[model samples]
Target chain A: MNRRTFLKDAIVVITGAALPAAALEWLDPRQVLAENPQIRWAFLVDTHKCAGCGFCVKACKAENDIPYEASVTRTWIERYVVTQSGELLADSPQGGRDGFTSGSIDLPGGTRVSEEEIIRGFFVPKLCNHCASPPCVQVCPVGATYATPQGVVLVDRQWCIGCGYCIMGCPYGARFFHPVHKSVDKCTLCTHRLTRGDASACVEACPFGARQVGNLHDPNDPVTRAVVSERIGVLRDSYGSRPRVYYLGLSKEVH
Target chain B: MKEYVWRPMYVVVLIAALSLAVRFFLLPHDFGVHEGGYKYGYYRLGNIAEWESRPALFRSADDCGDCHRQSESLSASPHAFISCQNCHGPAAGHPEDPPTLAIDTGRDLCLRCHADLSYPAGGRDAVPGIDPLGHHPFRSCVGCHDPHHPRQEVQP
Candidate 1:
């Protein structure tokens, strides 16, 4: 082939290959909205109803494939002991898996106190708040963590680089490194079950009906109604994460 | 154009082309900022499907009520609100290969909620708790109390 013709053909071939790649970038699909736009999931916990049975913790471990013996849990119950002298003691033994059977409250530095000085105590169940403005999502450099339109925050295990930034960013200390998956893991609000019109495993496992999940957009939802009618509060409202989990009868002693 | 200028321009263009090509293949097809816009954050669009595909291990009490007559006995009792799977373990597969599910009859099982820590507030007082040592030391709860009908004694 002539030199001039060969140069022209080479340029054309390169242009042709590069054109498609450039076009594909522009043609990339935009992420779609949630399947049900009207549905926003919210959680409710009745502090008065939680009996500290630890059934929810066990059920969550089983349902989510978290190791039963793992020190971390997707859900856990904390017993708060407020003494007459204004000292606050909080402890969660084995994440309340076996319940609080001890008469003494053990402190972090090995100090222990008998129940005699305690004036009041209560069990508070905690999990991922699935905040509307989740700090975890904000701090995820790789975009592995995100919030669903339904208000549930989820971690994309495959995409997570295991940087642990999201775990540190969380205000409630909700996220944890999975012992097996080696990625930052937390509660998904049982997105698998919720999508199928069933309650989250923890909610269903609560015997006294302490935990509940509901559609915030649906005014008729029992949980929504209770939230509207009851004097409920979220944990650490000052953080402004706009947490979706609401607690009934939340005491001032709780952090 | 000068030869020196042309050579530098060519090198820059080639590197840009190579980088673009690599990114096109490395980026996941389903990764992007979702419906809530940038404030809500970006994630793999397919992760929703991945999460939804996980099998539910725990089932509701209504699922058990469909087969076991003992469920009826529980409804009228104080334990009605509790799911069978709570104490019975996740009902992922049952009454087929295993034929029957194992029941937790340990004293610790019952004492989990009933053991008296004497916490006077925050609804702990609602469920009556007993001093494990003072009440029935080292005895199985089911020996006398019927779990299905917790208020009633087991007939000899």
Candidate 2:
């Protein structure tokens, strides 16, 4: 079936099971979804192989016309360093790859090298975790932020009240409130692109294939099975958000 | 107490109806941008498949000055490529709301990329220090620094 038909069917199946009886007849989610699935997107990150290259971050801004000079990162690269003595330091690269010649990264996934400091190091690309059980959804007062059955969390700018609660609730600190839109924002994992079986900007931009996208329920799906075969670690699994993105061969201390 | 009527809903009816609302109305659907000029920009997106009909979008930083029209001093800095979102966050929804939906994540977004002291624009050009107000308890680096272009002044 075509995408529209599939969406309509999925909506009927899920919403027919979720909404209140009073609101069903007037606003049947099923009928609508029989047209679309709302926001359906998810990601799986492999930490073991990420080069800490800021390519994803750079690429996101470039593709979207995101400004080049600000501290805002729709996506970013992190440097994680672990010492033999068990000291851990995490930082985003200070100047990204463009400024990498200096080798200074003091933020998440940064390098801590000195004459005496013996350590292991690597990088991870960080973006919105896009959780199935998103806390950002619970804290939104106007219901602007909501999750799709497929588990992508999104905000409706028209309804947003400018509250920053979603920013606080995000376990990965991924949300960014912007001035132009004057709305709380984060990576949407390029939800619009997924309409035609496209991957997110970050996933496509990475030269290393460190980022993967797919559904967990579908066993044959690469991301679903990779999490099992590769021993992926969900960032702060303790937050209980059940983030879909998984990092492989990650240093425990990096979390 | 009587306001709390406990009528049971049919299992199938209850599940189907609720699922529809949650699946469609409550969630945020994708609204893609169709702005021109990004054959290679971060926001200049395209199909993910390697062999897709479209090529990736990218742009030169100076192109932004045409519309933003910042003063020559602010617009010409090396941090010119730093788009508005680099400092303010994604603006896709900004036009719908004014100055509010875009809550401040504080200025740390700036410091995350550029440190407090010294940054370059082009060809080894440099601007030093992110200190906004030396007196405020918040570290100058944390607040005054505008990462979009550290060479520029802090937004009030």
DockQ of each: 0.50, 0.04
> What lDDT is obtained when candidate 1 is compared to the true structure?
0.86
Q: Name model 1 segments beyond 4 Å from true.
A: A1-37, B1-3, B70-73
Q: Model 2's CAPRI class?
A: incorrect
Q: Quick one: best DockQ, which candidate? A: 1
Worst 10 residues of 1 chain B by lDDT: B94-103
In candidate 1, what are the lDDT values of residues A152-255, reduced to their tens digit? 89999999999999889999988999999989999999999998889999999888889999999878899999999999999999999999999999998888
- Which stretches in model 2 have alpha-carbon errors above 4 Å? A1-40, A83-86, A94-99, A104-118, B1-156
| Clashing residue pairs found in predicted model 1 | none
Write the residue-wise lDDT of candidate 2 on B46-124 in tens digits. Answer: 2222213233342222333555668675556555534444334334334455463243444343333332222221111
lDDT of 1 by residue, B1-156 (tens): 889989989999999999989978998977888877776658888888899889988775577767777646566888777788877867777756454565788888888788887658455577778898888799988999988788999998
Top candidate (TM-score): 1
Q: Candidate 2 chain A vs. true chain A: TM-score? A: 0.75
Return the interface RMSD of the candidates, in order shown, one decimal each.
1.4, 14.2
What local lDDT does model 2 show for residue B38? 18
Native-interface RMSD of candidate 1 = 1.4
